[model samples]
Target: MSDDATPDATSERAAALGLTSPAAEEGAAGPVRFAVVGSGWRAEFFLRMAVLMPERFAVVGVVSRTAERGAEVTARWGTPTFRTVGELLAATDPELVVVSVPWDVTPVVTRELVEAGTPVLAETPPAPDAAGLRTLWEQVGASGLVQVAEHSPVMPAHAARHRLLQDGAIGQVTSVQISSTHMYHAVAVIRRLLGAGFEPVRITAQRFAAPLMNPRTRAGWTGDRDPVEASTILALLDLGEGRSAVYDFTDNQWHNPLRADRLLVRGSHGELLDDRVTRWLDGETTIDSPLVRSQSGIGQDLDGYDLQHLSFEGQVVYRNPFVGARLSDDDIAVATLLDRTGAWVRGQGEPPYPLAEGSQDHLISLAVEEAAGTGQPITTEREAWAG
Candidate 1:
């Protein structure tokens, strides 16, 4: 959940629908019911959260178009499943609807929930394109509903990074470089750091593709489109100061798999590099650097995950903040969002990842795609990420 304000209308609407418990009405203590709209890989994570933190989340119902898939999840999780939105909602009337279905199909589920006025926490890339996003905006406007994106950057990793930047750990007003084969996460990071709101500007590029599906997933999976892997470059507009984030996308490493994430911040005094988020001072000294990861997790990252040990001031080593953090990436993110959501339920706060910010993520990715396709820099001149 983002730290954005939830207008009174939105709040009242959410409250009226019994979407959640209001502070004054907390006497009737029952778990807040939630429905998972898709039963794919991501759906499992949301379901996992429900089991991990049963006090906070409940899997009231699940919706999957395919009976086989739905039954698989229902059997494994011991929850009811349905084949359609109407059936799921009619059965559970969940307060929060978690949409993890296909990008293009998400709008359909979103419309149903928003029309029913259920608070939504849709999966990443809520829409396939700007046009699809517009459908959601229109639906919400037509009926006034609350929804949030499930993008991780809106959580602590980004919140802490923003706070630290504001705290002057690396000093402000500079530039940055980021590379990713995944466009959405990269754009989300840039938007969060740049403090720009959602809304893609007129992008100037084209897209490239190759053959898409494999035996695991038939053509029905990817709209029968090719190009499993892609490369993209994103640049910010109206760059005066503050920060600039450069983005890169590469072909998905099917046979040649490599997970590459690097970040470098150029400051007036020094720089910081990579996921370690290490800081440098006076061009030759290190301030705070943590030793990187060495353990491997199965099926966690497409490419096995490892955080390389980082060095500071040419000698001193730092401790791993995550050594005892006891939080998975998904756990850290969704948990924080739930914290904000709980606050909203109690009338203490508002939604974390708002529609506008989610749209900004979409636009940024679109801009990057356009740029990569056309071989020109697309400019999001003033598309501020409203939240």
Candidate 2:
């Protein structure tokens, strides 16, 4: 650990690693005023972020599908709620609107917001399936008013690794293996690491079942101690041009303690497995380094138990923009997405994650499930969004 490294040396190392603190990258843009179009469990992530960092975000209003839901949200958050998007817009001029409805309703809400000439930050898997995705892309792909809330690539650890790959720390990234979150979320990380963009892919997959104890979930523990049958799906994606990705997922892996998340990025010069990176420094020199995280309030420290930043080889690779917010890594990623969306809507930053990219991730993920079910290889074709 190079905690005592000089500032100049650390800055040089950080530049070499292609690391830029988020605050430095995106200048302070002030509080972003936005409204949410749904009141589901996922919508609370956005609401909670506003509550945690009121200086950075302001939830202008919430648009629930029903008056009861709107009242419930207003009762809990004390933020005004409306029964329709039009009502929310008429009351509050939010800079952007977040669409967090169900899978089937996402495209509709997104289209409505787009037609209203409002910038939108839509939830993942912009559409339900391939056909829906194509149709939605045809309607709004060119409007440049939509950004998908794909947060995996922005997670601190994953963001650090992506920066390293971008800097060629590990020569040219050839392949990636991810066994983290399920479906499109994992695929988003794989595509980001490989720098794959709407490329046609050939996928082969298989599913297996085994008995595993299931305890915890996002909701909490299910006291049933019996081992239940769990399904695991493994897939191989060939994205032409010597690039590939391995997708592995198991039911309840996100919360199951028995299943640890894993990631592997193999490049021409080296490979990064989880937090440790092994790379060739010279003809005869191979170096290994671990990604170190700085957490406050541990033992002697009393800064109130929060993640400060992530560092590699003494260089700060990724710094938590909301240091004192005390948010988890996942929440940090989501909040970053929200912040970037606000910036993009104001034309201050690049689009966080475009809808086309999210569509491709889901398209590939859907093919994986299809391949596993049919026991046959599946190849994707170019879609409307690819153009």
In terms of TM-score, the best-performing candidate is: 2
**C-alpha TM-score for every candidate:** 0.69, 0.92
Global local distance difference test of model 2: 0.86
C-alpha lDDT score of every prediction, in listed order:
0.57, 0.86
For model 2 the TM-score comes to: 0.92
Q: Put down candidate 2 lDDT per residue, 1-387, tens digits, no spaces.
A: 001111233234334434322222323766899999888898988887776666677788888777777666765665778878887787788999999988999999899989999999999889999999999999999999999999989999999999888888899999999998999999999989999988789999999999999988878998879999999999999999999999999999999988999999999999999999999999899999998999998999977778999898898989988887778898999999999898888788899998889999999999999999999999999888888
Clashes of 1: 19
Model 1, runs deviating above 4 Å: 1-31, 141-144, 154-159, 198-242, 253-257, 267-269, 275-327, 381-387
Q: Provide the lowest-lDDT 10-residue window in model 2.
A: 1-10
Candidate achieving the largest lDDT? 2
The pairs that clash in candidate 2 are: none
